[model samples]
Target: MAAGAPRIFVSHLSGIAVFDPAGDQVGRVRDLVVMLRVGQRPPRLLGLVVELATRRRIFLPMTRVTAIQSGQVITTGVLNVRRFEQRPTERLVFGELLDRRVTLTETGEEVSVLDLSVHQLPARREWEIDRVFVRKGRKGSAFRRAKGEALTVEWTAVTGFSLEEQGQGAESLLATFEQLRPADLANVLHHLSPKRRAEVAAALDDDRLADVLEELPEDDQIEILGKLKEERAADVLEAMDPDDAADLLGELPTDDQERLLRLMQPGDAADMRRLMSYEDRTAGGLMTTEPIVLRPDATVADALARVRNADLSPALAAQVYVCRPPDETPTGKYLGTVHFQRLLREPPPSLVSSILDRDLQPLDPEAELPAIAGFFATYDMVAAPVVDEAGSLLGAVTVDDVLDHMLPEDWRETEFHLDEEVATDGS
Candidate 1:
């Protein structure tokens, strides 16, 4: 810790309420923002990412922070409600720094960073990292440190393995990304250099990479896909939602797409080929072929479990499809749909067929965008089934995919469009 300077560990700051001079709670600390610099100098603290009561994230500069105490942070009441955008030199302390690998200069042993402390310079507006909490043993739990036994060391005595120090290496990048949600990781990936982005993408597991790819803009998705080996790219495509995978494949040259598709599993390749046959704006093109399917004999409990799958998006999981024998697309037969709400209201052991919305018809595979939108509005459903001429369930269109088609082609690149809830306090 700096001489006579009050300090708080970064981990302890999570969820700490922020109060104005009058002790009126304004928001809570979400993450600490800092600038990454060259040399061994500690990264300069930039501001705090604060979440308002309304759940909007905003930036609160260090200049507005008057005091940092246990359980609460006192601020100058001058909060900037602008959405926090990390600049090229900046990083989030908790997001990219906490839980990272660092080497203790004195012991020459690698340890996991548990927390970091920053201190303001005497009579100055500057705040810089001065102390770090580290735990011995790379595989040990981060919370296993001895009680009241401070392992705080001078920041200069240890080395951070973040992107700035590690260059385009995947290990350090993986360390940071491992803690982030796929969408959050995607946001960070979008801001990195092309080479760095490729390195990070290569380091991610197929499923994790697929999740992150689904969140990236179409252009970014294509560029990163091009960097991967052909076989690995095929695997990632298979892991992605069939709709998203097909859309990306459509952007590639026909021969290139064919070669890559041939590398994928036979079943997956067939599905992608089928999806590619539909126009991009049609219901078939906007649907995922992997919607949870249940036999009529399946119970409500089974329906609930399927919708809770981590891989399925919330919109796609809003309902379950009731199909006849051979519960695969093109399914044996389309019976009806069962909304999750109905499952919750019904007895756990009740058959799914008993609660099926038989009157709810499926969309034709070639249904246009306007028709799909009308179906969602009229039925008040997040997803609707798509069927073929033989009445086989091909897939289900999700509201998110429909919205994507309705928006401009470059909507993902538009800052305001990316996050609908992002707004300012009129400051």
Candidate 2:
């Protein structure tokens, strides 16, 4: 469901089809995983257990889930096919919570849980079980109740499913900071002790940890990554931006890098290897492998649709690169650029190739930092496409990446006084 959507009963979602952005069926939702809090607080909705066509059930984290509507769940098309292994802290909504006997706080009468309603918190991406559908009756493990009166009550009214204690792990901390931005959350993690940091990192979903890792200092990134399992580390790396992932992989021992690369998807591994082939401060090294690339025949509507993606950074969405046949980097032939503003001004069906800015030269893959900075400054551009010797589009180097490389090496240490805020006694 979209943010601010009405609470959805669990029964409505059971057995629903799950599809990727391309509208291809990936699986069917079998159950949901949630983590119960210490008190009467409603459990946090972690993810869905989706059974793929092969009948292998995998965990589809809420972070990767873009929308839930009438009959299907739409994901960001990023799937981790790893088998779903229930963690110590997780509780299955269907298998465990439903048809269970729980006590009503006021009446002291036992009731059977028929269904639970989950809602996304206002203006936040987090979802939680806010209401419980229950009937006053003797407890039995049956989904249907034919006799007693049934009513939907707030989650706080019932008390039967075991609640986690406050001090055990990172569940409390994660719930407390569920709404934090990646950078702000990174600051929180930086202040934590190594053991606690590892705990919190382990608790965070891959997409979240990936964003936080991008904002963390290189040392902190390496430390937290080192503490994770190799497979998980590879998954987190795959979730990160191609440029950032390549930078992290570059710091590891060659053998360690190779091992992680082997665990990653072949396409992602190739991007990392290609990025690592460039000098650290060069355009090729700084550019993200995934850019908004469209073919010559793509319409303004197509370009606008791609730009609407919430996952893209502002700079990356500022413009789109129009190329020849293969609409992926290294794209067929580096044609030209189509700015978002131009897309807006043109008719929806207008061809993007017709309005391209061909006069502006694309950056050479090996362009140095100073030259890249100069190019941005001279053209007043937020992003510029990078092309290789054979005229293939390598990727686009964004202005943020240029400034990141040009800034002092210790910039992240003092970046917004994170060091002082994280220090003991603020010393």
Candidate 3:
């Protein structure tokens, strides 16, 4: 084997063949076993399964294996036919060792792992297996128990072979946010190093980034934002709702906040500025620029087509508003709102006015937070349209925006916990 090449392990005595000095097949590889010490008992090589050309499986001693290579195994000597007749135990030790999860100690916490490490002792010319490293679970807590608390095992503590399954059909060493639930992603973020966090943020698409950001704590959001370049920070902010953008920007240094705002699109920047202009705890401050508006004369087909053309967020309101003109009043004078599902099910050629629900509930742009929350709760609304005093439609507020205000501190902490959990689980 070449020095420093990736190492591989095969089942000992797994019907491998070896060549002698004359370049002839000698015998099948029998056993490559290691001894474990559980408080000073004499170590044993442990029996291994070996097979011969006669189609017989046998128990082979550990000393038989001479060399191991990428594609084949070599044995020390040719075996007698009768020696291969003995049957070995059907169960393999390695499989049993890996079947259970391990917990390693780290910074006074236990970390769960799917595998352990194996090492060779040159001085004693023996192999040693000790210390298990965890790859999943809470950011700082492990699934397994140790002496008092899980002990942090050093990298050097791992000596030889890794117990993790190799080759195909193994769990991936690297985990992506897609593989994790939003809650899990939040937990993992807390444990990630600054650079790793940046890498993960950079890897997430705009929509996913927005979702993950909404779940993160304010302090974490500010920390992550500080680490990102202006353009990337702007991209993440652009993906966030106006209220979220305002809150995160409020947490950042004034200069950084201004620089990021400058990098955002003019319209997005304007909306964020307007939202921030209001007191942080008001309805206008939390509304989104995602109201569904349709011209009164527009047919159900036209409205559906417009919906198709627009890049609407998933959290958008189900109700589509009907307006006489873009700048006209949105009160009783105009055709009201219709559920999107109703529009889709109705005949395409039907006029929006024929199905518009006139029993519309509108929100004042300057309404207080509690009143808006009550409106959302009472009506069971995902979004409520906001209008000026003259009833000119301003924008809309979604449930998530309201949630930010209702439980600001708890929400931030939950997000922080989630980020930490994901990092530990990912490792």
The root-mean-square deviation over C-alpha atoms between each candidate and the true structure, in angstroms, is: 11.2, 17.1, 19.6
Candidate 1 stretches with Cα past 4 Å from truth are: 1-57, 60-168, 414-427
Among the numbered candidates, top lDDT falls to 2
**lDDT, candidate 2, at 153:** 93
lDDT of 1 by residue, 190-302 (tens): 76767678888888899999999988898899999999999999999999999999999999999999999899999999999999999998989888999989999999999
Better of 1 and 2 by TM-score: 1
Tens digit of lDDT per residue, candidate 2, span 1-427? 7888888898888999998777878899999998776567678888999998999888887877788887789987767777877764578999999998889989999989999999998887678999998988666554676588899899998888744343656887788778778887886677566777899999999999999999888999999999999999999999999999999999999999999999999999999999999999899999998999999999999999999999999999999999887877888988899998899999999999999999889998888999999999999999999999888899989988887888887565432411211111122
Model 2, C-alpha of 73: deviation from truth (Å): 56
Cα lDDT of model 3 overall? 0.58
Most TM-score-accurate candidate = 1
Model 2 local distance difference test score: 0.86
In candidate 3, which residue ranges exceed 4 Å CA deviation? Answer: 1-175, 181-183, 306-317, 327-335, 412-427
TM-score of 3: 0.55
